[model samples]
Target: MQTDPTKDIGSVFGRSWTLLSSNWIIIVPAIIIGIIAGLIAALVTPTYYMDTSGVYPVPVYHSMLGLSLVVGTMIATFVGMLANVVILTMTTGMAAAAWKTGKAMISDGMDALRRPNVLSAMLMLIVVSLVLSLLTLVTLGLAGLISLVVFFFLIYTIAAAVVGGFSGMDALKESFEVAKTSWLTTLIVVVLLGVVAFLATLLAAAFHFVPFIGPIIAAAISGVIVAFFSLVLVGEYNDLRGRAHPAVAAQPPFTAPPAVPPL
Candidate 1:
């Protein structure tokens, strides 16, 4: 089916606004889930700084040192790749659950945690993340941009699969098909949303800079924005599947106003 990029964008944004206006109750649970997940990620992952020292010596020594460095780097790279797989798998499972409920935030996060397939889905995510990360690393940073593209595709696919009651592979395939049909438009929408998110973050940061009540307000704003995005994504998925959103359908048709009677 032909996809109308503009329509999809409109549907997503419209539904997002509607969700914010009327379904805020759902946002609370989702935000709680995000907070828990964020805390876990921050606590579990150790912060490490890489310190590199340069040595200048004879050609032979330099060559040997270079080979050693390369070998060590490769080994470390493989380990990092494995870690990425684990992280992505877990996050993807959470994302899938969120998508299934059409709430964007982790409304179903606890229930999703009870599912047997969540683990397997997370494993798949880890594998995909590792592969993408390695590719990006190999390309001297150009691959990073591609990785972002892949990340979004993967996220939508995982969410669709979970929501559509399909396997991870099937979901990934469908996402690719959708992306292929309207890649440029999809990219544009994503970029625009990202810019909006960045601005929101900046504004939140300004609030956070206040001496008191700053952090609390910033967190609240961030949570609201996250909720907004989640609903929008759900709406976008529905639109892609040909579902007619009430808001979109209810939009008043263009009409000319009646001419006033001459007085």
Candidate 2:
């Protein structure tokens, strides 16, 4: 396994930002797809109306599919999730290119979709999501903590698929190995990137009220954030690969030394 003194979570995030700012176009596809998916969802989802009763007005929900609302919602939701996966796979490819070569084009993103076994990667994602959902339900939400840990462990599966050309199941195994090798660092990356994503979402929410362009602007912002998150995952994957899994309580948590020396 390979390790570096200056490849900590902080530097991974810093490098991701640098790559993202320069290759902002990498997020265009994601933004476009997000808008399309949102429109599709809006068209398929139901709306609520105000029903005036004798003394009050109450909100009455109406599904476009009437009695089949649940089925319709599931189909719409699956389509949205599929769109999200496609966007993430493309962005991961672009982000991987940008991280490695300091540049990437939209075509590079498209090329990632052409990679063999990409569908398997998508299937693995669905499996993981179902597992997490089942865990949450079975444990009455106590499994939230376990789900987070599972998330941290498997977070790099798509990146591995994109960067290492691993198939879905293989990528999951690889990600687990890398996460085990640098468990602490992986945990930190998951938490910090999560925070950044949360903050970016809050910022993007402000763009939704800006008229016709609001959705576009919000999608762009969200696309950029998602791209950066994917980029950092690639970076961290590179940082942890080849390193031996640390024995519990045997070594200090991984921390890359700062780039600059303090006087």
Candidate 3:
């Protein structure tokens, strides 16, 4: 059966929270590793401050320091990218669990990665990301206008492929179809979820104050946010999908009229 499209979009957060809080025990382990990685990112990432309050040129770092800074920044950039991917895949595991599979618990979500079709779905995800990244850049962020309209749209492709066992092409078709339901609501849900993601960063920063397990704390926080966000996607997808194809009663099969006298 299809979901009711008239549901209040704002309540998505409340439903997400309810689902997440209810499944904490099953959700925590999967995300802790990712949040820990984010915490490590904070440590390796350098902080720069240039005091220009002095003379016209102001005080700048020494030549050696400048060269070192450039090298450090380059290395840090690479490392940060890797950390980001790790966190993305980790949280994506949760999203897949909630979207592709029926269960939303952490373990089931993590286990989604082990599915045979997951490899294809993941490859598709990477392809979509690269193409979208290029498109968004080529437009000088203008593609973000479209992205805002359908940023989470492609995930539907992967979800259908994995969950519904549909072919990649079919999944791709379904994604756009479902995306057409309510652009405004989709955009709002995305922005709200992004705030939760940023909160994971804040949690990582806060956990840095902890003694030995700071990174671990951060990773756990990040994971929890992913779980909540994933559940929200599940709810939103159902609503939009229902709007796309509302349920219809099954039709009765036709029966041939009883044979009468031959003509």
Task: Using lDDT, give the best candidate's number.
Answer: 2
TM-scores, each model vs. reference: 0.60, 0.79, 0.59
How do the residues 35-70 of candidate 3 rate in per-residue lDDT, one tens digit apiece?
555466566555666656663343345554566666
Q: How many clashing pairs does model 1 include?
A: 4
Candidate 2 structure quality by residue, lDDT tens digits, 130-177? 677667778899999988778778888888788767898998898888
Which regions in candidate 3 have their CA more than 4 angstroms from the true location? Answer: 1-12, 25-107, 134-150, 247-263
Q: Cα miss at 234, model 2 (Å)?
A: 0.9
Among these predictions, the greatest TM-score belongs to 2
Each model's lDDT comes to 0.56, 0.79, 0.58
What stretches of model 1 exceed 4 Å from their correct place?
1-4, 33-107, 116-119, 135-140, 242-263
lDDT of 3 at 252: 45
**Per-residue lDDT of 112 in model 1:** 44
Ranking by lDDT: 2, 3, 1
Cα deviation of 190, candidate 2, in Å: 1.1
Q: Per-residue alpha-carbon lDDT of model 1 for 58-129, expressed as tens digits?
A: 665667656766666665555455443333333333444444443334435445444545444545666676
The segments of candidate 2 whose C-alpha lies over 4 angstroms from its true place after superposition are: 1-7, 48-66, 134-143, 244-263
